[model samples]
Target: LDRRSTFAAEVCGCQVEIGAAGAMGAAAVVEAAGGTALQACDAAATVFQNIMGSVCDLVQGIVEIPCHSRNAALASMAFLCADM
Candidate 1:
């Protein structure tokens, strides 16, 4: 357990979300930080529109191929969406 790290984010994504969780969580954070719900939904929808994880991406029971980059990229994308 010590090997894993912890974060202090406003909200966190879950395993069920797979690919777009980061962006969605980021949107939630923005909303929690005073952004409107519409903004958050727009941000999450934007990120989801860009990239979405799928079961087809799984390989050998591992879904690590693009999740790392996808999550990071999408998380940042949410901010742009919220701003717009």
Candidate 2:
């Protein structure tokens, strides 16, 4: 987690001039699951894409629909894929 957070912060700082929001927590979990920094990032992007694919801005409000669960599943799958 710590390493991820640092890497995220560094990336954000270098790229966008802003501090990272959830990079640390994300990084920690990925690292704990035995992912390298590059792999973790790729996995994260896959997870994000999976979630975003199902998200919708409804007439009443923004809704995730099936994206949240899908993202979680995809994240795990991505981690496994990265390992391989």
Candidate 3:
């Protein structure tokens, strides 16, 4: 039980860190493309929604499952959003 709880916490923390990194990436991209950071962030959010497609929350309480993939996807999306 303790290990499970720790895993959950770690997963949650990773998710939060991913979000922050995504935001920063988006800002950088937007700045590079001559767009506003807010607009880039909005685009990133849309990209996230499309990529995740209603699949929210981790299943089996495993962080390595969707969390890892989503984090990577988010980083890519941030770059794409900034370019657009």
Best-performing candidate as measured by TM-score: 3
Using all chains and alpha carbons, the TM-scores for the candidates as numbered come to: 0.50, 0.36, 0.51
Would you list the C-alpha lDDT of every candidate in the order shown? 0.56, 0.43, 0.62
Q: Between 2 and 3, whose TM-score is larger?
A: 3
TM-score, model 1 to reference? 0.50
**Which candidate model has the greater TM-score, 1 or 2?**
1
Candidate number that wins on lDDT, 1 or 2: 1
Candidate achieving the largest lDDT: 3
Misplaced by over 4 Å in model 2 are: 1-26, 57-84
lDDT of model 1 at position 15: 25
Residues 1-84, candidate 2: write the lDDT tens digits: 245444342333321111122233345567888778986676555444433323233434533433344445554655454444
lDDT of 2 at 62: 30
Ranking by lDDT: 3, 1, 2
Q: Per-candidate RMSD vs. true structure? A: 8.4, 8.7, 7.4
What are the per-residue Cα lDDT tens digits for candidate 3 across 1-84? 134333243544554555556756776777777887578767666554444333446678864677678787788877776666
Q: For model 3, name the residue pairs that clash.
A: none
Off by over 4 Å in 1: 1-18, 53-63
- Candidate 1 per-residue C-alpha lDDT over 22-54 given as tens digits, one digit per residue, 9 for 90 to 100: 556758777878987777877767666655333
Compare candidates 1 and 3 on lDDT and give the better one.
Answer: 3
